[model samples]
Target: MSVDILIIEDEPGLSRMLATTLGAQGYAVSTAMRADEALARVAVDDPALILLDLGLPDGDGLQLLPLLKQRCQAQVLIVSARDQESDKIAALDAGAEDYLTKPFSVAELLARLRVAQRRRQEAAPVTQCYRAGELVVDLDQRQVSLAGEPVKLTPKEYQLLAILAQAGGRVVTHAQLLQAIWGRHHSDDTHYLRIYLRQLRQKLERDASEPRYLLTEPGVGYRLGDGTA
Candidate 1:
């Protein structure tokens, strides 16, 4: 049977509580008490999401973030006692999609999990052809064009553009973009995003200085230009 969620938490009581609660809600939940065990289970279970706690008897959960991201497509949500801002940012940059400090209410945990599942459902393959002014993205084909001409983009740049395009006109936060592209550990590296955004503008914009399709929201994030000529 397939697992919908994997809880990689070392605390037996908390693990049982999570499993029991989530299972009651009609989710197929799996639990692992150590990092190595979690990795092994992930390989076999093919879970859609993971609830990870950083402190483990064998290894640190934060250290496993990148490996888990590389090995599986599951969305990882960090559940740890480390409440420091640096720890949260580090986890986010390391590839974790969300972080919930300990002492959190079970109701909130369930709500967050539901949101993550909903996003996955929405992002699942359907017909996706995005357009913003002269730029066109055929998501199904993984191709892009500018003013009827094909445009070339590095894998990372394409990923960035694809995310913005997927958002339609809504703003994609810096943390979101960074976590999506470079992993969670790089969330605070806004400079990296800036450098890439400049490259994208140069390649896709008629005038990089005054971009029309790709727009920046100072102190917030970025958005694809509204689909207006």
Candidate 2:
């Protein structure tokens, strides 16, 4: 059976209310009151989306956020009573796709769910291989080559390259690329990107100083060059 929603909230009343409300909308909903239970449920249910609460009986949900993101394919939307900006940022940076403070309206929750689902759909890959100039990226094969010569890459290097190639020449923001490769916690870690980008240019470009295919957008982000020499 397909599970669309998993509500990982400790409060029985709130969990039941959310389950009832979402079930009424024709979504298959599951609930877990503890962190371990939620992890097990996620393993079994493989829900498309999760409504998580940070304050749990057994553990802090913020600590569990990265684990959940690593283990599950679900888009986590944190619904918690923690209203502090730090809490919100920490949850988000820990990989929660979105954060919702408690006492939230059902309407807003549903709307945000819709937005998350839409974004997921948009981000889904439509193609496997991307080509620009002499560089060829076969995403499915997890390989990159230049001028038909195989180019070995570290996992992180390939990840950064794949993200840029996936953009199809459009600029991918530093934050977006960082989050995609290094998790949301490192979204501001541009130094990592810079170091990796430099390495990628060395391997893939004939001239690392004047990069050909890996184009930087200065203050914005980076994108694959327009297949031009």
Candidate 3:
């Protein structure tokens, strides 16, 4: 499963920005504009981290903070325009993991997320070179090959293929692949997958029209096979 995140910001533009930014980093993101909606999402989605704004259309973020904390185990990171010291103290005391005033840098936001998620990832396995049939993925050296020859791939194409390679022949959902590539920006966009997969097969397969390795799982997702199945 992918890392899940919720952005509780009301601004459409900013919400989209955060969702897309986080989504591309391999997070499964959901958004809520109102306090009630936020609460419902918290109870359902159970996000790993919540990026909250102090001002909501239905209620003050501060007033809703305690309610959110009481219901879920997520780490709340307040992203607000309120920069007063007292405001910060109240939020921290109310159980926020961290706070960032408005107009924050994306770098800092990502850094804070890493810190919040560090503990959960303390035992994740290190990625090693992978091989299946004629395909070879040397993640450490950042290279891929088909059969005995090198195959050139665009950065996005490589990312798409690497994700499948890492799946170890198991099917990876379409949403997972899209989120990793463009975040939530390409939700329900099947054409993106078609284009990239076609490109990958053209380079990796002996005949793109009759793919032997990149197999589609009907309505489910895609899987990589060693062409022996």
TM-score for each prediction?
Answer: 0.63, 0.60, 0.52
Q: What pairs collide in candidate 2? A: none
Residues 20-100, model 3: lDDT tens digits: 999898889999999999999988888888899989999999999999888877778899999886677567656576778
Rank candidates, TM-score, best first: 1, 2, 3
RMSD (CA, angstroms), candidate 2 = 8.2
Can you write out model 2's per-residue Cα lDDT over 1-229, one digit (the tens) per residue? 4499999999999999999999998889999999999889988998899999999999999998888888877888999888886676567556677778989999999998997786566456666788778899999999999999999999999999998877665556777898888888997889998999999988988888888899986666787885574
> Against the hidden true structure, what lDDT does model 3 obtain?
0.81
Question: lDDT scores for all predictions?
Answer: 0.85, 0.85, 0.81
Compose the digit string of candidate 1's lDDT tens values, residues 1-229: 4699999998999999999999999999999998899889989999999999999999888888898998888878899999887677678657676778999998999988986786567564468987667789888899999889999999989999999888655457789898889898998899988999999989988888888888986666787884342
Sorted by lDDT (best first), the order is 1, 2, 3
Off by over 4 Å in 3: 1-3, 119-229
Top candidate by TM-score: 1
Error of 1 at 136 (Å): 11
Find the 10 residues in a row with the least total lDDT in model 2.
118-127
Q: CA shift at 89, candidate 1, in angstroms?
A: 1.5
On a 0 to 1 TM-score scale, where does candidate 1 land against the true structure?
A: 0.63
